[model samples]
Target chain A: MNGLSLTDLTWAVPLPVVIPLAAAGLALVLWRNARAQGVISVVALSLVLVTSVALLVAADDGPLVLDIGSWAAPVGIDLVADRLSTLMLTVSSAVTLCVLLYSLAQGLADNNAETPVAIFHPTYLVLTAGVANAFLTGDLFNLFVGFEMLLVASYVLITLGGTGERIRAGTIYIVVSLLSSMLFLLAVALVYAATGTVNMAQLAVRLQQIDPDVAFALQLLLLLAFGIKAAVFPLFAWLPDSYPTAPAPVTAVFAGLLTKVGVYAIIRTQTLLFPDGRADDLLMWVALATMLVGILGAVAQNDVKRMISFTLVSHIGYMVFGIALSTEAGLSAAIFYVAHHITVQTTLFLVVGLMERRGGSTSLDALGGLARIAPLLAVMFFLPAMNLAGIPPLSGFLGKAGLIQAGAEVGTPLAYTLVAGGIVTSLLTLYAIVKAWNKAFWQPAPEEPREVALPRGMVGSAAALVVAGVALTVVAGPLYDYTERAAATLRDREQYVTAVLPGGRGEGRSADVTDEARREGGTDRVEEGSDLEDVGPRGGEQPAPPEEETGSDEGTDEGGTP
Target chain B: MIDTSPSLALVVVAAALTAVGVYLLLERSLTRVLLGVIFLSNAVNVVLLVSGGRAGGAPIVDYTDEDSMSDPLPQALILTAIVITLGMTAFLLAMAYRSWQLNQHDEVQDDLEDRRVAQRAARDEAAYLSDDDGTTTLEQEAAEVHDETGDDGPPSSGPGTPPSSAPGSHAVPTPEGGDAR
Candidate 1:
């Protein structure tokens, strides 16, 4: 859409990851000055937000690939800014920016007690960089690296101040995350062994030639790894148990961004590598369970934070449901739902933090009369709460409507079951949210409500997030259109493959080495009807094993094995 | 093309390491869990080594023919995984040490909030038990679900006391901790 060239846009692809990382180091150096750390973090995240938006616009024309250090595809790692990734990056950066502002305000208001400025600023920045890297990376191993970057930072953030309770929660979170990382590593190793390359676009081309069973195994392993991170049902127990213990902004950011990254990975791989939809039925069942069981857990909770955490797990099912359909409408709606959930969930947590402050406790039994006492907090809580429940005229409602409509278009028995399950989940979400609202805002106070003064910075940032969620509803038309185009690009795998590997080779200096090597090695080998037969010296005198040479030769001669 | 078959010995060793690591991971002690994490990551790293085509000459382009060279990519990946595991090992150890200092034990504690939820469910179940039913009474259920963490009410300010009302526990300690809430 712009007058800029692909090379010019490609250069900006890595900045979202690099800027925060550089600022993280800078913040670490100035740790003694909390003000400087806060300013550096705010400025760095704002820059990331800006770059992500720019890429989001530029990628509308086509996917942009940056082969790091000019090493070429299937060899060097690459960072791709496609419509799906750039959109996710934009939403996540905006959410992270808002969370950063809120945390900065909390740090300043607390004089940096609960969150030590020295460690918090650096770790938070690293977390943002890791998230950006995850969204942008076109290499599977780099995605794993991105996950580790964030998880390690999250480990420190979760256990900040070394509180006994936090330490307990942090251990569970860390061990579980480490185990998932191990599985992901093993999956990466297997993918490399099976396909001989880790670049996703190349994998998209090569995986089609591998044994279908092995590809299916790889898919399941990857799903298992990401499922734990995403907190899907049966794997979601760790989420509500650990998340409520951290300070508010930390919990809010984790609630909003972390699991969605896992969802983003699932979307990318399902569409790009394994488009046959072998796992769609399985994903459908899993999504159904995640939705029903999560909301059931939410309904059973007596604490506001834990209740919200359960709902967070419940809503992840909706996104997975969309992916399971493997339809354009399904994917488009899933993407829209992911964007909506990130903002609304984060806003709810921040609002709950304010409620905790006003009520003197997060327990439903202890909190009461907050609607009369803090009318502003009540309104803040009400808007996002309703939006999360998929109330009409809200983004949440529009996203769910899209998913249901997509399911109806499919019209399978299971699809119908999912549609029914989805509606039930929505109703349950409303019930759970309404219950918490009634107890926290409407019920009579057991004791006098606290007169604590909510900091203007914290309230402003949280309010900004709430307004952003509402704004999603306001711009739902254009955003949905954008997601529809993104899903179309995702569905057409050739666009991604060709963009990353132009003309049967990556647009890098070293890509010619493989071509030259094949040419030199061809004199002694028999031609097997290769299109490269005319390009090289073909001989039939010495016939060699056709299997292995065919793979390497075809891979070089024709980027797509066919 | 190079030999792509992995050695059976490495595969067997990796399987054994994973088995033992998973067993240790099921243990309650943080130290054992830490060891489990170490063993498990190493097992995956070894698998990574095996995933690269069978051992060949050093991968240096000039030192070995292209056909005989080992795939260098998996090795690079393994190095990255090893470094990450090392950082994680150090962090987990520090956390284990801190846990021991605070609670005199390195065992991962069952979530107190989870226990409370279970206790509440049990109480509701007891309310359904008839006079002649064999189900346990409310008192017995409470004892069965009781934990070391206090269950009386909201947490009061003091050192050495478990924060019974753990959710929003920071709300009550604003003065000492300078909590933003």
Candidate 2:
């Protein structure tokens, strides 16, 4: 165990969450000043981005741990920042920062300069905090709390303008989310009933000991709860309806990030708690159906926002496919796909926001000759649209390539079908984007404005995001390597369990995993005999792998140069 | 099933509440749906209680006579769930009230676009199911979809449709009124 007194637990672990949370409280008090709100939101998100990047760097050596109130492992709510979480946090914060800039520009353009909607800043910050918390939390209960934070903030964000449609859509969104959360709560209760502890680390050990039938049933409940949130297959009815009606920036943020949070939670629980890939055949079927059916729905839509909303639902299948495979390559590709999708998705939505501003509509039928009018907007839309549709040399294609490669490696008949389905979805996504393009950008001026003036900041934000999407390609090699290492960590479920519950077997259980036993130099703050050692396997003479992942120097070469 | 009596009673209550709740959820009325959600959530809470498996003393054991502590965590989880459910229910109530103020009823209306999309989907599915496999482009299908009820096609230029509930750049209801049902 990392020997530590109360003082040993520190800020490095919780900074990403705490910074925004504290800043949100500050923003709430300063809500009267639009300038203050904008500055506060921007600065707060910037801090989060920087801290998340720093956390990602720090986590390379080992998983960073912060036990609140100094209550150690399985007993207290611990926050862990390992490779997967910090990667998500970093990308999400960057997207949020850009979105904040875009929204501030929107406020200025809307001529609400003085009244600059106070609620948006605080609520947005809270939502970010909730996401960060969900990523970092070490227990199921705290994960539930993290989800509620998201709901509270999202409910406010979804209905910010108080329009009839926004409210109506929000009602559907909230009701669906509430139902999912209720299921999640019930799942948690059952978990506590089955295992005496709510800590994920402890449950990992205990769940294995429970009857296979009981474990499988519990797994299904958890899957069902998160599946709705992730908008998988039959559970996805609410997303397309609710998402398209929000104000453009809100819709953009929601599109870019929200469902990914659900996906992240699913990945964590599936990988950490249940590694056997239970009913994986069923999951692959669901993934294929989700991909094919969702794209068909996207094809049916004529509006840009609605089309993207449908695509958002569809792409979730890709990540789910990775999860279903339950291979190291599959998990790694899933992580890569998530990051790639987030950037590309957010950029496209921001472009939609711009298109809505310039042409006065996102309805494809009502829009034409946008390229002639606003070529910059067209380029912004073009690159990401191509990227999203899996055009070559872009991150989207790269991500799909990785997933398909993984699927090929799996080589099962079902996996082959999903790979084929994935290719179909990609083509349909491109087709959907092109349909929007023909109507909104390329067609002769059915209704072209004499002059076009865009909010500079908003355009800048969108451009920045588009570049970030491109940068994913630029650094695909490194990012893929990182994902591989992260996936490697996930693949060795016992590594995580042992890391979280040190000496988990008993008082004198020697470190069995050789790799973990070797990295003593990097281990810090492990206590020799903390009082919290009452449960689980015991003694460790040699230090544990303090650095979570040893450098995957080979991954760089294997991933191939970008 | 150590505490068979209460667990059995609770299970029955859960089944009944969930059944009624689900039945009410099928109604078009928003209030009914809201009530159903509440009932469903409450039923889930009771089920959560039963999952704790038994009733015993406090979970605190000082190592003397430690048999069972009634698993206080589920009770705690149930408390958190209740608070969250209350928050959600209150929000639902507010939405219902607002809908009433706007439309004079809380009967949820179908999204016009969603209905159109579904109709198109059914048509496409039927087309796919048929042996011909016509291979109609999705763009063609999307463009061809028109309300058979004598309404103008979307990108609607009818000059009568209110902007209300029309999701577009111009979300605010403007006097430019240009399309209608």
Candidate 3:
């Protein structure tokens, strides 16, 4: 167990999950007291932010695995704190904290219909908890649980007031999410049957040893499961439909995290378990298709929310492109891209919400001349719009630059094609943003529209995100380095395997497990070993070489006999 | 596990559900479409469950017998899927009800199409009005002839008209300026 005790960190590892959950309970208890619920939510999210930062610092050097209740791996649930997981937690917490504040401001302003403000605080806390859990979970089953936790919460948030527009959008969102969950469940079963383990670490090792055909099928199934959640190419139809209908804060969070969670799962699976670039070529093709189709959809939309939704889908392609390259630089770029996209997308949605507030409707046809009426609101929209379009001195540009650089380094025709696809998507994204600006702000105000006024404190909430987005751009160098380090760690299976499995060494130690094999089936034995080692810290190893090793691992695993 | 080869039965059930779902989805009625989505989702869930093997074996593990455990992972996944589906179904129903209230209709028709038809009719009506000189005015003809001339004629007195002396008058001009006395 690395001679480190869970008590040593003063329960910091589990606090990220626990604090929000407890806060959710408290908020529910204080549901009748709006101010109290708001205060509780703020305090809880602040704690989460602090814990997430501490966890990041603690896990900076390597990964940290916590076996709940000190039970052995595979038997007890595990919460893993790796660079990737902690980074995700950190970003999610920050974005969510902003979103919570925004929602609180929105509720307090009393601009919305007679929905219960009290319910929002608790549900939002639950949603944050779910996101944290999903990012930190080592077990696949727990990942599903985390997804369901947030899905239920989101369903309520999406349909909060039972408003017609919200209901219309929320309905599609729920149905699509439910279907995705089903796909995920089906995938888990196949993976469990094929490898007899649902722990990600164990499955990674065991999956390598399964029959090639079975493994391939299982990989495809898992991809489909996560792909649907992430809104990848063929599976992204529900996103635009559902996202546009939710209230501003709800839409912002969903745009920022929901599909990204799916993308996060894809990244973890592709890098940790199935590192084979060949097997994931299909993903690359899908990435291109997703970018093209999503932008095309965005261009066709006249509604501000719907346009942003499509742009969200389009930007997802960049992350997929980074992951599909299956190189250190590419994966690192993908990580950076994920972080950048989360902030920028959320900020943009918030701005759209503001636009909807000030301009009566989100319909481009109905809105005009907002820039003249409210320049501050225009700034909010402009910054995020430019960031999303990948303009220079913005985090979006840095993220795209990283991906393009990685693609160029790979020097393959397919890689170049993806690079071009990314560029085109960016241009289209800019066009969509400009179109929105022209209709909602630059053009003259329409006659006979509702007199929409920007709500108090809404601008402040949006400004917080804009400031963060700008800060991300300013601090791109350090952030890129961090992502690169994390990606390197992810590429190296040896460090991860050794950390999880007791007596795990660099070489495959099958002979030692032969005895255990006689006691349990081969699948069961492998599963137990992996569960124990999945969350352990990486020992001494250089970061750069893991990239080459990952490539070789992919080649050998696919070509070598089982 | 059911003693029957559940794969065949599973396939039949999935197909039937899908057929019903597709039919419902194609219907103009939002309620039917929502039902179709539910059935379609359930069918997909069944497909996922069946894909993992259908032998009536418990997924729970007995330490004593290693091979006897059925695949519990799928069952766990199915539980979550069901919950998500239920939430989604509720949301959809809510939206259907809301849509009915807003438009007073259950059918999903494109707003753009409706706008286009309305616009075409408006244009045709304008053309018909132009043909009848009684409804057309000299100012309208003059403005149409010299669009760039910054002249829209005098504004009309409409109900709920803003007071002309309002502070924001310089900022915006009325659309009916040319028609008013």
> Candidate 2, residues A178-293: lDDT per residue as tens digits?
77887888778667656556889777766776565667777888989999989999999999888877777787888877898889988998888888778688789889988988
Error of 2 at B122 (Å): 8.1
Lowest summed lDDT over 10 consecutive residues: which window, candidate 1 chain B? Answer: B155-164
Against the true structure, candidate 2 has what lDDT?
Answer: 0.75
Question: Which residue pairs in candidate 1 collide?
Answer: none
State the displacement of the C-alpha of residue A400, model 1, in Å, after optimal TM-score superposition.
0.4
- Best by the lDDT measure: 1
Candidate achieving higher lDDT, 1 or 3: 1
Where model 1 places Cα greater than 4 Å from the true spot, the runs are A1-7, A504-562, B125-181
Model 3 stretches with alpha carbons more than 4 Å out: A1-10, A446-456, A504-562, B1-181
- How would the candidate models be sorted by lDDT, starting from the highest? 1, 2, 3
Which ranking of candidates, highest DockQ first?
Answer: 1, 2, 3
Residue-level lDDT of model 1, residues A1-562, one tens digit each, is 2334553477789999999999999999897788898899999999999999989998998888877886655567888899999999999999999988988787777654555668888999999999999999999999999999999999988987667678888999999999999999999988877766788987786667656767788899999999999999879989998898888888999999999999999999999999999999999999999999999999888778989999999999999999999999999999999999999999999999888877777767667889999999999999999999999999999999999999999999999999999999999999989888877798777677667898898899999999999999999999999999999999999999877754443343334653553354343222211322221111111113443454354334323312
Error of 1 at A74 (Å): 1.5
* Model 3 agreement with the true structure over A202-306: per-residue lDDT tens digits: 777776765566667767877888888888889997787777656788889999998898899888888888876556578889999999999987876656777
Error of 3 at B67 (Å): 7.2
Model 1 lDDT at residue A529: 19
lDDT of each: 0.82, 0.75, 0.71
The regions of model 2 sitting more than 4 angstroms off are A1-10, A112-116, A450-452, A504-562, B1-6, B58-68, B118-181
DockQ of 3: 0.08
